[model samples]
Target: MNRKNGITVCIIAIIAVVLIYAQSGISFGDPVYQDMDQYFLLNGQVQTGGNNICTDVVFDFRAFDTLGEATVLFTAVMGVIVIFRRLMKGEEYEAE
Candidate 1:
């Protein structure tokens, strides 16, 4: 097969696999452990002293995880900016 047909076949195969996986009995957004959910619902406010349980869980219980996510996002944005800046440096552009 030619390159374009080969690429199209690969993409269709990937999509078919994804559709099959989605149809499987895997559950999304379902908590595996009920005890942890119960503990969070019961003592989340008392331990964190936060009115919003979701906010408390993110900012307090999972602070390090949240920080890591933010760091990764910031690094990705910076890397993209650096790459674009280098690419644009060779071209003439008007600055406002």
Candidate 2:
């Protein structure tokens, strides 16, 4: 194969590997017993230290996790900006 074909194959292979890895997720089996109220109080009130379970889960117990997720979004936005700048080169727009 020619050099162009080789580079194309390499790029395709890299993309396939990335997609495969990105789609993989954790799978937890069903629990033997279910207790809704107890589970809610334990995970929500005790762990999160908040009066409201829902609020605790979202802001208190998962505050650090939310921050981490925001960082990932920020990183993705920066990556897109970098890629766009490279693709546009001298033709990039300038804001006043």
Q: Please, what are the lDDT tens digits per residue for candidate 1 over residues 1-81?
A: 899999999999999999998767668777567897788889999999998998988999889989999999999997897
Instruction: Give, for candidate 1, the lowest lDDT window spanning 10 residues.
Output: 87-96
Task: Tell me, by lDDT, which candidate is best.
Answer: 1
Point out the worst 10-residue segment of candidate 2 by lDDT.
Answer: 23-32
- Which residues of candidate 1, in runs, are more than 4 Å off? 1-32, 88-96
All candidates: TM-score: 0.56, 0.42
- Model 2 agreement with the true structure over 1-96: per-residue lDDT tens digits: 999999999999999999888766534565436686567777776666778887776677568988898899999998997778767767855544
What's the residue-level lDDT of 47 in candidate 1?
98
